[model samples]
Target: MSSVPLSFEQLGSYSPMDFLTPHYRQQLHASLQYLQRPAGTLLLHKGERSLAQYYLLSGKVAVDAGPARQTFEGGSPQAHMPLNGSQPNPATVKALTDVSLFAVEHQLLERLLGWSQEAAYQVSSLGGMVEEQADEDWLARLLGTPLFGRLAPSHLHALLARFDYVEVEAGQRVVSYGEPGEHFYVIKRGRASISLPSAYSEQPALTLGEGEFFGEEALISGAVRSASVTMLEAGELARLHREDFVELVRPTLIPQISRNELARLSQQGSRKYLLLDVRLALEYRLGHQPESLNLPVANLRTHADSLDRDTSYVVTPEGGIRSELAVHLLNQLGFDAYLLGEQPPLAA
Candidate 1:
């Protein structure tokens, strides 16, 4: 076992790590686990499943695959890739010398890889359509948003194709409080303020600049808009109709799980998942699942950095927009979250 300082530069040298965008690489670095094993230690037996993708940082490891045996050394070109492939590793692996390794959750690695590929494809698809430098800049910023980063390539392309461009004048209200949410809007060239009705005095209004988005809460929950969005200046916007948003984006962004399924998952997995109630603290105090954690949806952005990325969160379904909004925010922040379904089947 060893305590070695691993820099971002050394991390950048790994295969898929080299392929990831800087932003994605930084996100991966936050929760990456550093591991070390002494010489003669058994890393993995043949046919054992690996939950993480491990990369050799230093020392030597011997791999035995059937009749073939090979020794891999750290800093070698061969060591730049994951020591173990997907689950059920075919090779028996042992540390030949004291070894240092960095392990990324297998699912996390795959998700980041998928997003990286989709982002590159999106850039390519833009081609000659990016007319101005400013347009190019905003497009890049838009791509960096968590919503866009998480979308499947097909859904991304389709959503991009379906957006309707709109021009807004300063002080115009795009969507007002209590109105049904008709569209999800992405700011292309302007600023806007989001504020709830005067009755909700506790929460302050928020400003959003270009490349930011809004209105998803209403669309996802089938509820009226809780806040009004007013343009601060004349700006361009790209809006997706509610139907399009639901059809093209909802499936990927907001997955739902029945209560029974969640119970079954808890019983079957070694990993423990958590239930999150996203209603306000007062609302939570009135009634909430005893085991669930209460963190209001509005405060999720501010508090989410402290959350465990390895744990999956199930948002309670009772709060409608509040719960769904929390799921969206959590997913955007790179947390695994699912909405609890409204109905659960009778126990057998």
Candidate 2:
């Protein structure tokens, strides 16, 4: 343990442990060291071995792992807990600016909490708050949000655990159209909007809000993004990457697609009426209309020869940007094409 003693005065205007109870806060203060870090520094990296649980005193830190990357402003002290596994040392801890931190080794924390009931209670409470934060973060990134008015606590808790936190500033493009969609996002704080290139005219389509989630279709089907999503407000977000999504959320969601909708599209299968799945190649492989040809909207023009001009085509894309754009594209090519399902108009 470092000999540097902690003073309540040094905690500045920020709460010592915003996530902890008063009793636990007192316990934590007894066993922490306050250290300062400079800008452009990395505090931790993905797949690092467990170390001390760091409580940020001041400044900011970025946590990057796989498809979930976020930067957190350590306005108040926040704890850092390493995941259990084959621990790789951190890749970097470069500072973004001058930073102040309170460090406590993991073993020391376990021992302290193990010995003190008050400490344990406080830590547990803090843990609950951390978990809540994760949920809020996830909901904020969605583009077309479901009505969450009736979600149960148990259901909400299950959803929260699967999300990874992301942070972005205003004017940043989170997802771009014509790129592979790998994850879905929900906002925790701030705001974002969807943007699409206009086909009929030069005007672009745009929509903005919190709680709304875009890219739901791509997330399920492994398709390319149908539109671009950009942050309109600077804040935090929670994301569910593709792997976690498939294991945790997909099974529950797949059953919700009505059988009637499936049959309606299937009934259209014939020589005169062709099903053109406008989803990307990877998405088409995941699952699609059995009789539909996998011609992604981007490559539709190039692959025009594959389709007969006399055939009436049905354009079906996952959601938002892709389907509408596809309908417009096929029309430009002089194919009698119509979108299959009812949904929000393509972003302007």
- lDDT leader: 1
In candidate 2, what are the lDDT values of residues 54-143, reduced to their tens digit?
A: 555556666555566555665432323322212454333445667676665444344333323332332233233345544333432221
Q: Candidates' TM-scores?
A: 0.73, 0.34
State the lDDT of candidate 1 residue by residue for 63-117, as single tens digits: 8998999998988888898878767777888999999988886656776666576
Score candidate 2 by lDDT: 0.54
How far is each candidate from the true structure, as Cα RMSD in Å? 5.1, 24.4
Please list the C-alpha lDDT of all candidates, in the order they appear.
0.77, 0.54
Give the lowest summed-lDDT range of ten residues in model 2. Answer: 142-151
TM-score of 1: 0.73
